[model samples]
Target: MRLKGKVALVAGAGTGIGAATARRFVAEGASVVLTGRRPGPLAEVAADLGEAALAVPADMADTAQAREAVRAGVERFGSLDVVIANAGGHGGNAVADTDDEDWRLSIESNLTTCFVTCREALPALVESKGAIVVVSSIAGLTAGPAVAGYVTTKHALVGLTRSIARDYGPRGVRVNCLCPGWVRTPMADEQMDELVERDGITRDEAYALVTKDVPLRRPATAEEIAAICLFLASPESAIMTGSVIVADGGATAVDLPTLAFA
Candidate 1:
């Protein structure tokens, strides 16, 4: 068991990458606190994890809730040895099309939520000399056509990871960012459906086009992403900190302008 005595707090643990990571953390012997806005899904995931998991239904966008989520896990498991700030959704909009509320909500949900969770979890992690993994996306490392807000915030996470790493590494706490590309999740499914409806294409065709730039020809599974999060939190990556590990199936490695020749 990689995390035999560790206690982990996973935000956005109700579904997708967060859910998968929470399950994987448990399998690796960590007691996990699952926090998200959805109670039913949190309950279900916690049930599957049995006694090792506690479900805390709360909106991560709210700073108070994020802090409370961390506290709950520390209370139950004695110390917070790991924290995965993996809660986020796409803010689908063009630069000009994004209203103030859209931009604000996007920042709050993606960037601020991460900051809140990490800040609240720091003292516990500091005590344990634990690790923090912030989940960003490929969108954070590079630019997408119209997702200005997402791109901006994702990039912010990279800097955030580095900043926290520098400040806390001396104190024995490690920090890093997990940058994933398109993953086969509910959020990605919604994008696929939108493509199908808007372009009058079959689901498979839409999926193909969406993944065409990805050299792997498909998206990563939630389990795959979760596995990496496990590595980041475990002692296996002890020497790694302030790193932005991009797991994108070679999507970012491709040169889009020369794609047809390759």
Candidate 2:
């Protein structure tokens, strides 16, 4: 009931964290507008949410489509109370081998999409004094061997969120970023399989190796991430703004061992 009578727009709502956030929002009494590249998956989620959900198929990378998606949501729900810029992907490329195309694509997919959606939704959010929750990643804070493009783009979002929050918090618009670690989503599963094939290891071994740095010894669940987003979107976090909340199971807290010391 925290979101009762609120209107929310969730991008990338076809699966994973986006889908989980949509479902959680609807359950809390918010009428949701769910958008994703695939119409089938969006429609399925909307159907499951009953009358409170609207499925709007869109590719967030397209600036025009992203703007129209926000506009359509406002048209249906009368006003917009929350916006979740959750559409992004990881492009695997080492810094040495990354091409301009790969870097640009990663920027467009992760950072540009959030920029477009937030710009489009700003007017409506200002009118309603709503909150914006951006879904970033733990890679934004820590470094890895590969995924240079992904790491940079995710880090860029944190900066953008803070800037927007600083400028608009006085105007009653709250903006925050949620940085999640490895989560058991379809995308994570694909990454795990790719590691297995690349490293010639069993699936279990691949998962364990990847999560070895995490103190929890396992990845987070989609619902767990959704719950955090819900709290941020609700009045419970009214005093919170320009915050970077990390849900990484302490993966980034561990220090790498020095060769000389070892």
By lDDT, the best candidate is 2
Return the lDDT, model 2, position 10: 97
lDDT of 2 by residue, 58-140 (tens): 88778789888888888888999999999989567799888989988889889998888888889999999999999999877
Worst 10 residues of 2 by lDDT: 253-262
TM-score of each: 0.96, 0.94
Alpha carbon deviation, residue 193, candidate 1 (Å): 0.4
Clashing pairs in 2: none
Model 1 has an lDDT value of 0.90
Which digits, one per residue and each the tens of the lDDT, describe model 1 over residues 1-262? 9999889999999999999999999999999999988899999999999999999998877878888888888888899998899887757689999999989988988898888889988999899999999999998889888788889998998998999999999999999899999888888888889998999998778778988878899888999999999999988999999999999999999887997787
